[model samples]
Target: MERRTAEDRGTGTDGDTAAAPLPGRAAVVIVGGGVLGASVAFHLAEAGVRGVLLLERDTPAAGSSGKPVGGVRAQFSDPLNIRIGRRSLEAWRAFGERPGADIGFAQVGYLFLLGDATERALFEEGVAAQNALGVPSRIIGPAEAAALCPYLDPDSIVAAAHCPTDGYALPREAVAGYLRAAARHGAAIRTHCPVTAIDIRDGALDAVRTPHGTVRTTTVICCAGAWSAEVGAMAGVRLPVTPLRRQIAFTGPLDTPPPRIPFTLDFASTAYFHNDGAGGLLLGMSDPRQQPGFGREFSREWLAPFREAAGRRAPALATLPVSHGWAGLYETTPDHNALIGEAADVPRFLYATGFSGHGFLQAPAVGELIRDLYLGREPFLDIGPLAASRFDGPAGEGNAGHTGARPEAHII
Candidate 1:
């Protein structure tokens, strides 16, 4: 993959240039330049912590962060997820008003369509859970849902969970904003620098070895996204994240685009689509047949299934022409949730990965959470439920029990 920095994308900088010389040592070494890593660096610097080094093999947002559909929402099945989503949404809203960041965030809303009784029940439960966390999400009947998003085929959906505060943002902008801010706050970002190994001494993190040089740091955080497992292995800690290929297609400009609608999802099929801010529509769906790997090549085979599913849920887009398509990896876990906090077995080694497909949306809250964990401060939200220690059984006997974790149905 080609290495491109935020400067290449023309995102304003906070005065410090990126791709600086790899230093011999630092207080903390963040191995990854995606949004999550950048967020951690930015928050740490903002909190008065200095000498932080952020390394990226490619560039900021070059991984999953760059390819995401950029949906931000607070409607989640779990209470922790809902709380994190709410906090993340608040940060997204404040980005534009803050220094060096305007993520082009829009609150067009999100609507998950429920087709059957079981789907309706699950969605209702999810909505109640979200509401209890102060998220303004509700289960609306088909008619109300259709009123909110007229493009949806009401007959195909029995009920829908709608959250008006949920929407999308520009991932690249967010990454660039964080990098620039981190740089200004005395953090160094190095692109095209990959950590080859994690040095551990006496069961404690010693340093990070890279091609350029070895960074002697006691604290290391892995935000490598899909490649987290490989990075963790260098430190003798096994991560359960698997890289799953996800594809998305964009429609050509429409003569008459549908009214500004929420990011719509067919909960049963996981088929989803939303406006691209341009006149076109962005659409995608998970391929059940897709095997976990690093394959990021787009496939024509997925187009037909996505179209068919979209047509059934949103008849208005049945015949829309797909002008272009792209593929990205989703660092999925057994529970379809993120693994946050310090690794129980690896002292001085922290983690903020395994977000399944929700990393980009949750990066803001995650950045803060990781900063809190690293600094030994009270985190804004209790992240015990997301610890990597949850899968301590047969499934994790060899690879840290990541395979034993349960699957989350609310994915997508």
Candidate 2:
């Protein structure tokens, strides 16, 4: 294998991109090249951590990280996650200074549409948490919501929450930025290197075996997205992550582009749409009947339910002709939250996965958190609650340990 200080710079999602001669040894080995892996490697290498090697099964971002566009927001129901979102947004806004890449970040804002009093109340409470953390998000009436996004019907939504600072950025560019920076800092990134096995001895990680070759190391970081469970299993750790297919479609370019609107979502139906940055719109929704698996083939059949939800929420979008689509996997857990913590049984084996669909948005912060872990420093915040060991207890008891799990309410 060749040493890849550069090349293979896709966001750490599906796979593809790089490889040079493989090193026989490394101080650390990162599995998965998705945005999380790239972010983590960048942080570690930037901090002067030596012998860093990031291996990908395919081109970085080839997985879910390679989405057409990724949402970034600080809108969360819990303070802990809100803090994570806030810090990440700051990093994204200043990405050019740190990773030095134009990620095409836009702060058009995020609008969450509430269709009923129950959802309205929940968002009202969430907005308070967000405001306390310095996020300028507010709950607005249907009239104000329709004003912000003219495509919405004031009669359809009872209430809405808008955060003027939240928006999205290019995922593939973000991944390349992080990995390219990591390379400059003396980190080695190799592509086409699927981790076949992890060697453990006496409860400590000894080495990582891949299709290319085995590299001896005491530290291993698992940033694998949908395949995180398989990576965790190689280390005898139980990461209860399941893969689910999420699809999105783009309308053909129009004669008149829709006005640039906040990334909007109909919270009640989980339907959402945003400006494609082209003369079109991007549309998607969660198919309640979607089976949990690694099947990411874009099936137009799912669009039927998406359009049905749009009919009730945004009538105009219901009849919009979709030009093309893409499908990706979401590494979901029982709680639909992320799993970020080191394994208790496996020494120095760290993992930050099961992000469900927030991996790209949370990559920067997760990278910092894992870097702190490898350095034995306290993280910026307590992530102990997101430990996989939480599953050690009975079902629904995932929030019983460490700092205790906070409520994860916002969904799109």
Candidate 3:
């Protein structure tokens, strides 16, 4: 596996024209080369948009896109999220048909455990909503849940909502596919080109000034994730995107790994574990108390609670040593939901950040939505709820500073 770091620089014109000036003016310039940006780039190119450029400050997928747990599910509390995720899932299911390399996708499924009665009721409601949305999911008692996976401890789970149609997608593979397809469709992705400043001319995006050079673009789509607020600030737009830290760990291959196991989420502890499909397991837990910031340091202290919780949920996993662990940042918003649609104040500026943790699964739909906005086509999904104008109002004004909408513990 490639150890994704910030030093993997791409070919450049003497590191001065690193940002690569657009051919006069690009139809669209996407900031950030992560999964979201790649998806948008590919979608835009597929729409026959000429002169599409994707700018990356660091290595592609160096951010959350590379470290994503790849959990794709429709078990969201919000209807819009569910709908968007459902569309993306369908795209993944039909990935082979797309104009890109196969992402090695599989229907590993997802199992979200509920320990408390209140949470259990909420799970039931979510399951019902998912079913109504055509997601094959249902609530199951502890016995039934454990029956599906013999390794599961029946006594540990009070209830669980199982969704066989939802599972993980190889985010790295998917991003690679998008980049290749986008390039084939005439989209150029430039890396090591950090946008130091976004130049606005007469209340519109004029060009982006990068460390390498300036890129003239009419439409600037901010998909910088946690760093979106900083990018927005360049345009003098007070976007409320906050960078939050989320950590994850992986274990060595087991001697006798289970043939198949759903990606299980222990809601009681905000811990999640899943088989890595290579005789290994991946486990993670988020720290709710952790503040939002950009840091990738390892901490041994979080292991104790993680191990204790994992043992209670899957005793066999406790024996496996956590071979490696890494942390990344999630650009979150006040509502813990993504900020999509165009910025009312900035007509040409489209916001696609603040996905919190759901960005990976929603990438496909977001790509389609952004493509529609650029091509003058209808959006694939209803993204009215994720508009940037939501934070422009009085109530949203004060709440924009608040990033407490999503539980930090769910970062894993």
Point to the candidate with the largest TM-score: 2
Give the per-residue lDDT digits (tens) of candidate 2, residues 174-245: 998998889888898888889999999887999999877899999999999999999999999988899989
Q: What is the C-alpha RMSD of each candidate to the true structure, in Å?
A: 3.6, 3.1, 4.2
All candidates' TM-scores? 0.92, 0.94, 0.90
lDDT score of residue 386 within candidate 1: 77
Top of the candidates by lDDT: 2
CA lDDT of 92 in candidate 3? Answer: 85
What is the alpha-carbon lDDT for the whole of candidate 2? 0.86
Please provide, for model 1 over 285-339, each residue's C-alpha lDDT reduced to its tens digit, 9 standing for 90 to 100.
Answer: 8888899999988877887777788788888777788888899999987778788
Off by over 4 Å in 3: 1-22, 397-412
Where model 2 places Cα greater than 4 Å from the true spot, the runs are 1-19, 396-410
Per the 3 Å backbone cut-off, how many clashing residue pairs does candidate 2 have?
25
Poorest stretch of ten by lDDT in candidate 3: 7-16
How many residue pairs clash in model 3? Answer: 1
